[model samples]
Target chain A: MAEEITTTEEKTVDKDIAALLTSPPKRAPEPTPELTGKIVKPKIVQGAAAHYKPHVAKPEIQEKLGFPGTLVENWQEAAVAKMRELLGKYKSLQVYMDICVRCGSCTDKCQYFLSTRDPKNMPAGRAELFRQVYRKYFTTEGKIFGKLAGAVDFDLSLLAEWYSYFHQCSQCRRCSLYCPYGIDTAEISMAAREIMDSIGLGQKYTNEIIGKVHELGNNLGMNEAALRNAIEFVEEEIEEDTGVPVKLPINEEDAEVLLVTPSADFFATPHLESLVGYAKVFHQAGINWTLSTTAAEAGNFGMFVGSYYHMQKIASRIKQAIEELRPKRLVVGECGHAWRVAYAFWNTLIGPFDMLNQKYPRPQHICEFTLDLINRGALKIDKSANDEFVVTFHDSCNVARATRMGDKPGGQFDIPRELIKAVTNKYVDMEYDTIRERTFCCGGGGGLLTDELIDVRVKGAMPRMQALHNVMETHGVNFMALICAICKAQFTKIMPKYGIPMEVAGGVHQLVGRAIVLGAKE
Target chain B: MSGLTLLYTLFAYVAIAVFLVGFLARIWKYATTPSPLKIPLTPAPVNSVGVVYRMVQEVGFFKSLFYSNRIIWIGGYLMHIALLITIVKHLRFFFKTTPAALAWITSFEIYVGFIFFGALAFLFLMRLVIDRTYYLSLMQDYVLLIFLMLIAATGILTKYYVRTDIIKVKQFVMGLVQFRPEAIPGDPIFIIHFTLVLLLLIYFPFSKLMHSGGIFFSPTRNQVDDAREVRHVTPWAVKG
Candidate 1:
């Protein structure tokens, strides 16, 4: 009987691989009027969900991060042991596993489930994938009844399911908003990824980037010289555009603030524009700020892999920079999850900035800074500068749901909008549901932003695309402003595939950069 | 006492013992476990008083469910509320004299029975009709719901359709509570209902029904969004 079961599992695995190879690349279907609404129902599409899985991390990358170099012979035991350890460590995991009543409130909340129509992509369904294993190994009913209790043995097929389905989740925490108990699937997904990594299975995108952050101090692996060159290029461009020679200072001591942002701002288009906007903001406000080569990157991929130690290690680089530079305050630039880490996790991870000035927020968001200046009338504005395009803000999931911006609770949502409205006249919001704390992910967050997962990424963007399409038809909205580097890059690549121009996606500060007067304040 | 009466008395003690011990153990585990990060789903309350108010709304009103899907909220809220009222009405069994405060609850026991059964039936039917719910519903999920439905049905039957001697039933329950054994009346429907209730008590701690207790321990609902102001340190996590 066991042999027969193994053979069937092998056959199922082969079938999934075949489907993946032969399947056409999934694209966002054109939104019809009926399909574009505030509360859209999930459409069923067969075989659309099982065809994408990210490539696994190489053995060296796995070993460098303190995981096994290859799949252990006793991987099942190791995985189960890790689960037990996590269950003991995290109250979120323990309570979430026991409490879900399967009420189906979160069924339609996940964008992946809505777009892919894969039942496993449902938040509860995805959680059950982990819960089933927990039941099999931990619960008494599972011990006696097994399959009758919805428990499955830890087998190769289950491992494959974990790989395919857990990667489908963006860990955006949108589902938690609707969950009656606030059962954040992001917590479950993080636990699942941690367990997988323990058994020597890891995703190439997240683990490799984490490895880069360990070795090169950033995700992009750019050294100090390249970082300086990039800053020089931005300064040269600022001078060319406004003829103001705005200084993009790097590694300067005694600066009041250290501006830590995603390295993508140095490499990617539109992301670069936001970097320029930060420089222009600092220039206009006349606040002394310098970029740190030690902590050049702000985005923390450790959270994606569910490694708290690694997340702290990566965040500590900024702590090291802070101690070295003695900056009075820390300001984080436009990146979604980075802000979540900086604002929410950094105090716990690496904090007690007792040496710095305490009057300003320990770590302030750029929008909060820019909006503060705009409110004080310290920066001159040109509202007509962005009149060529009607704009709307795409609230990144982490910023929208995970962290706060100003002193208030929903300040993350308001500060960015206030900044955009202060700079541009044609600002509008997308849809009420899709904009604020209930926002959909850019489909490429939580380390699925690699090229190989493009199929899953494009399919996941369907709901957000539909919302954007609705506003486009109704409001003639030409530009979608974003606060996340991943959202900016993802939408820039994804909008073209949906028949929207790439230029339609840009940074909120891109609008600010266009409209901010570059001269000394009045 | 008859042989059947002695068997039931023994079963009742064992089931209650297991239920109390297991339920407390699970709650203790949840209470003692450390949540390392601040992950309150925002728009969360900022202060402890606000957290208490938020939790009250969640427990009392199922506020998140009301905002998520109205139909599920109606089914869940109705069933949970009805069950609470019915349980309070059942307090008459344990007390030699029913308390004055519970007099109102006992008066509406029959209507509460109807709502309880009706809501349980709705939830069970939903498990079959809704596609997502159907996919997630395991055999145990269905079995537990159907078992509760039958318990509710048998209870209503004993109360109205075939009246059992409530005086004897109360004496038996009061005797058991006071540690003085008495012969339980052997009505067939009553026996079945009593046995099912015992089974539910045994199953409650081990099954997903522990959501009753687990909800309070959910970190996302319980944690305050004060990570910036206060440093939340756990013993297990490394100190910086």
Candidate 2:
């Protein structure tokens, strides 16, 4: 009888595990608000995502980034002071604080809101966490009217909400696109994070990666030897696959171009595939390009956390690499926020690249570089090489909405698709409204791509997944091409949870890697 | 001048002063606030001229709103357009002789008032009915919407139900504009409309209504997307 009881208990435990794995622990899947191929306005559910925050950074990780080592005494006062400091420092913060009319245009625009059904995830609602504090402290109306002015005082509960909701935002700026005032929640989320960090609270995933980058020169913390060994393996993979000894030279000074990519490219699949593609493009184009050891990383977590100081400190390594290598030009690899920082913030954070060949745009996107080579007849692309995969390009939010590629307007959108078409025989866009500026985030970006927030990440990806599922049904699309490393990582891990194969996530250059005609220098 | 006329003249001057000073102060603050980064929301234009044209679409046509939600767009666009026509129609009062354009604009007549009322009413209902919008709307939001509704309601009533001495009302407004006091019209509807207008003017810069001018200063809307070509730097950037 005792043995029989033991067997029954074991069976019950197995059933519980299956249930947990199959369904969200908290609630059944929401009936997705009837979407119109445009916006999905989920019914509001308060506190829906309150449980899905990232792990807080350790004291040491916090200290490494120049934040307080722990929750300091008088945390409220310190947080308010930091808000004041940021308000004075960034005009985006100040304007966004006051100008939001609480219009509902942006309410349905956020992926987090649509997935979690969390009212707090609404772009304006997420921003209000900080805006409430801003109102309480800075604005005269808030000072007098308080809650009536849509402002609330800083307190434990509000801080908790700030931590949960701000971290939920990917800082994709998709909401900013629809906002009449262009009130960006990315700016607010960043400031909220900066304030939290100032008061000695920070996220572990971003801060630790940033700390690793500062110490080991990459987010993955692969030292020079490990990095070198990994690339050698990639080089071997290339030679074996294509019968070409295409070199991915590292730290070779005086090369014509210095390529800086996110460290995930060194070892991570799909990312590494793109990295291989970069080498092939240079090899065929016959440009003398070298990856630098010092500035090995391209993604900046500082931008994610909204700390310019950390962003610049992390970005300075690339500038140091540029100085040490003395390359005539700089080229960035397939990473989203890295491209944004390189294309937009690098000149401001780092400076006048008068040293580089002024004839070329100082830092060119890999897509631009590859496309130019293809356009100029400098390289050959065998379009039929990628026939096995019916591919669709996912426009990374940073690329589509934050930064541009070629000189033309909407170049960011056109350039990637142009590059994809040059290499692939079969290409399909997911949905018209879901492409270009209206593209949903790949569910993980802006440093929220950590394992601890898998539920948040998976649910947040619902909109993108549903859209992908639609295309997969109609067009038999087996591949989703992406440019961002975080997007790549997020989609690979989270896609399977939604019952889509993880292999559906492929890099744009992974396609390029297959298509590029190596040893065919035109 | 009668006592009511004298009292209104004083209130008008005060209201206009607060409106002008507050609006300018907010505008000045927005203008002087330094934008340390190039964060233009793309697909933004690359040059100054393109930016101007984009701003024209955003400000004049509510392009972003139109693209975002057609229901909200219809309500917002009509409301703002109605207000614009109504403001233009009021030009007849300020000018000694109404311009041909003003006469043509006023020809929209009670249609403008009805559209204004209808649109304002739709938006107010939207704020209450939409669950997401309801969650987002604060007391201030509802209060402002209802206040505007009341303003539009009174204006409509004056045109349709309680006909006022609008000619005398215009004369009184002209007197206020020219700093020459005239007898105020003695209609309750006219008094309420005039008082509401003055209060809204005074409240404009202090309230969310400053979106009128704030729209121009939004860096994402205003700045050109030429970060790659230009080495834009903040004054406070770390020096080597």
Candidate topping TM-score: 1
lDDT of each: 0.88, 0.86
Best by DockQ: 1
lDDT of 1 at B116: 95
Error of 2 at A83 (Å): 1.6
Candidate 1 collision pairs: none
DockQ of candidate model 1: 0.77
Give the Cα error of residue B135 in candidate 2, in Å: 0.7
TM-score, structure 2 vs. true: 0.93
* Candidate 2 per-residue C-alpha lDDT over A234-322 given as tens digits, one digit per residue, 9 for 90 to 100: 99999999899999999998999999888998988779899988999899888999999999999999999888888999999989998
lDDT by residue (A1-522, candidate 1, tens digit) is 999999998888667544432323555543422345454666545445776778788789999899886667688899999999999999999999999989999998998888778899999999999999999999998998999898889877688788888999999999999999999999999999999999888888899989998899889988889888888888898898889989988888999889999999997998999998888888888989999988899999999888898999999999999988878889999999998888888988887777778888878889998899889987888989999989988989998888887888788888898999999888778877787988999899998898878877887787888889888889999999988999988999888888889999999888888888887565
Model 1 misses residue A165 by how many Å?
0.6
